[model samples]
Each structure stands twice: as C-alpha cells, then as structure tokens.
Target: MKKANVAINKDLCKKCAICVHFCPKEVFTIDQDGYPLISRLDKCTGCRLCFLRCPDFALEVETELDD
Candidate 1:
C-alpha cells in the first residue's frame, strides 16, 4: 500500500482547525499559529476525509507516488 500525504496550504488556510477535528484517525493537529499540521501521518488511511471536510479547501490529501 502507498503512503498518503496530507498537505495544508497556509495561504488559503483560515486556521479554523476544522480539518483537525474532522479526521477520525487524528491525522491533523493545530499548530502554534492555530493552522493545521499533519500530526499523525502514519495513522492516515489515505481516506482524504480531512480535505473533503475542509470548508476553505485549505487542506489536501492524496496518494504519494512510490519512489
């Protein structure tokens, strides 16, 4: 299985932490600036749930190509 990546676009982010709460696997966390960070990358199931639930479309989750 491929490892998934969760990226947060700081420019568009509102620092709402919505993506942090929406993730059932706790894939995200609030940073010092209150923006979302990938807290548990290994826990991610590549479900893209955080991105889908983001209201500002600041977060993006995708399958990473194998190296």
Candidate 2:
C-alpha cells in the first residue's frame, strides 16, 4: 500500500474540525486548541478528501514514493 503524509498549516487553519470530520480514514484528531493533528498516519489511504474539503486549505495529503 502507498504511504501518505498529512500536513497541516497552523497559520491557515481556523480550528474548524472540517478535516477531522471529513476524513473517511479517521486520520485526524482535534488538539486542545481545536487544530487538526495527524493521529493515525499509518491508516491514511492517500485520499484527498480532507485536502479538497478544507475551507482554509490548511490540510494536505501527499503520497510517498517507495524507493
């Protein structure tokens, strides 16, 4: 399976848990400040739903290439 990396931009994030709720893989969790955090990166399926649904463009999903 392909590996995925999740990136969150704190500056752009508005603490709206949209990414956390939209992710089918449940890869994100809300922090104390209400920011999204990568909680289960290993379960990520490289789906861009979180990235595309983000209102602030703060979340990103990147597929990692195997060497």
- Point to the candidate with the largest TM-score: 2
Show where candidate 1 strays beyond 4 Å: 64-67
lDDT of 2 by residue, 1-67 (tens): 7788889999999988988898898988998888888889999989789899999988878897655
TM-score of each: 0.84, 0.90
Structure candidate 2, residue pairs in collision: none
* TM-score quality measure for candidate 1: 0.84
